[model samples]
Target chain A: DTAVSQTPKYLVTQMGNDKSIKCEQNLGHDTMYWYKQDSKKFLKIMFSYNNKELIINETVPNRFSPKSPDKAHLNLHINSLELGDSAVYFCASSQAGGGSTQYFGPGTRLTVL
Target chain B: SQQGEEDPQALSIQEGENATMNCSYKTSINNLQWYRQNSGRGLVHLILIRSNEREKHSGRLRVTLDTSKKSSSLLITASRAADTASYFCATVPTSGGYQKVTFGTGTKLQVIP
Candidate 1:
């Protein structure tokens, strides 16, 4: 069984359009996180939610928003997608503690043209 | 600024050869983890070493953490072609609240069959 899963493995949208990527984890974890990997393979954490509560919010642009409906799901919504938003977004889940292991979903590649 | 920085951005080795990757961080961390990401795939957790722990081993993977130097190293013994993937080091800071993990730029490893 897949522990963590993401929707729309690939997304190609024009600039100024809006898009959303959905993520779900079945590992019964309490903490979920969103990460953006740039072309250089630099992975950066964007947001994190613990037990459906916002916990970590990095220096991401205001256009990007993360919503966690429950402990098992965290979705990312981007408004006014720009070319710079083109990157692979990953969702991960953990047991909600420091030094806990994280299970990652197959990333969603977003291409803003 | 990135909290963790991996050395040797890229490495190529023959199958059966051992591969080593190093990571350096700037802050006090609760633990450091090593993850592998195959091309077009999400990151996979490999190993984790806590600040108080000096070394750990799992299968063919060995991890060592030196908090005094603020550095860590990952060693893969008898690497196979299947091990050709990008390896990253992630750090969980010692700060309070939800400890957000910061990932370093990965080391892309290529194993020649």
Candidate 2:
């Protein structure tokens, strides 16, 4: 079984549309994260959740919101998406806090036309 | 500015040779991690070295951390075509709980036969 799983491996939608990417990790990890990789392949952290508590929400636009229904499930909802929002979104999970290694999902390719 | 920037945006090496990549960060970190991405897939954790440690090894990979210079290096021994992928360095901030991991741009490695 995949330790960390993400749904909608590919998402291609028009601008202004709202979409949600679902992530789940069965590793019993306490921390989950959402990352965005731009065309330049620069990976940036968008949000982090620990036991369903909002931790780090980077300077992302208001259109992007992360909802953690529970410790195992973390979803990202982007409203009124723009063309600039096109990128690869990754979901990751880690067992302990800061010094540990992270396990990543396959990622969802979100293309806003 | 990005927290970690990898040097030699890309590298090509012959089979059986060794490949080296460097990463530099601007802030203090509690630990450094190395991950490998194969093609368009999610990243896989390779190794991690704490701030107090200088070197670590796993399988054919060797990671060196220099906290004084705020830099790190990943060395792959006996490179093979199977090792072709992108290598990234992630920094776990010293002050933040392990959730604040920031990834570098990555170094693309192509193992030539």
Candidate 3:
């Protein structure tokens, strides 16, 4: 079974438009994370949620927001998307606490024209 | 910010060869983990080594950790074409509570059959 899964494998939108990406994990993990991979292939963590509670919020712009309705799901919403937002967004899950192994989902390629 | 930086951004090798990737971090870590990502896919957990541990091996993968130097290395023996992928090192910092997980700049490996 696919332990972690993401919806909308590809998203192409115009500048200033808004978009959302969904993530789900069947691994019964308590923590979920959102990461952005730039064109240079640098992966950076943007947000992390533990049992639906916001735990980690990086120095990302306010235009990007992450919401976790339940422990099994986490979603990212970006407002006023700009050309700089054109990158791949990855979703991952892990057990609550430090040093836990993470399971990642197929990334969503976002293109902001 | 990215905590770990991997050396040798890319590596090319023939089948039956060994591949080595190094990662260096700037902070004290509770553990270091290795992940592999195939093109257009998500990251997959490979192995993990704790701060107290010096080395670990799982099948053809061997991982070494040096807490004094804040560095780690991953060695893959007998690489195959299927092993071509990007390898990343993630560190769980000793601080930051639950937000300590950080990924490194990945090293892309090309294993030719």
In the order shown, the candidates' Cα RMSDs to the true structure are 0.9, 1.1, 1.0
Per-residue lDDT of model 3, residues B14-107, tens digit only = 9999999999999898899999999999999999899999999999999999999989999999999999999999999888656467889999
Chain B TM, cand. 2: 0.96
Give per-residue CA lDDT, model 2, range A3-108, as digits (tens): 9999999999999999999999999999999999998888998998999999888899999999999999999999999999999999999997645888999999
For each candidate, give its TM-score against the true structure: 0.98, 0.97, 0.97
Q: In candidate 1, what are the lDDT values of residues B26-109, reduced to their tens digit?
A: 999999999999999999999988899999999999999999999999999999999999999999999867677889988999
What TM-score, to 2 decimals, does candidate 3 have?
0.97
The per-residue C-alpha lDDT of model 1 at residue A37 equals 94
lDDT of 1 by residue, A12-84 (tens): 9999999999999999999999999999999998998989988888899999999999899999999999999
Worst 10 residues of 1 chain A by lDDT: A94-103
Interface RMSD values, listed in order for every candidate: 1.2, 1.6, 1.3
**lDDT per residue (tens digit) for residues B30-112 in model 2:** 88999999999999999989999999999999999999999999999999999999999999887754448889999999999
lDDT of each: 0.93, 0.93, 0.93
Q: Candidate 3: give the clashing pairs.
A: none
Task: Extract clashing residue pairs from model 1.
Answer: none
Off by over 4 Å in 1: none
In order, the B-chain TM-scores come to 0.98, 0.96, 0.97
Model 3 regions more than 4 Å off? none
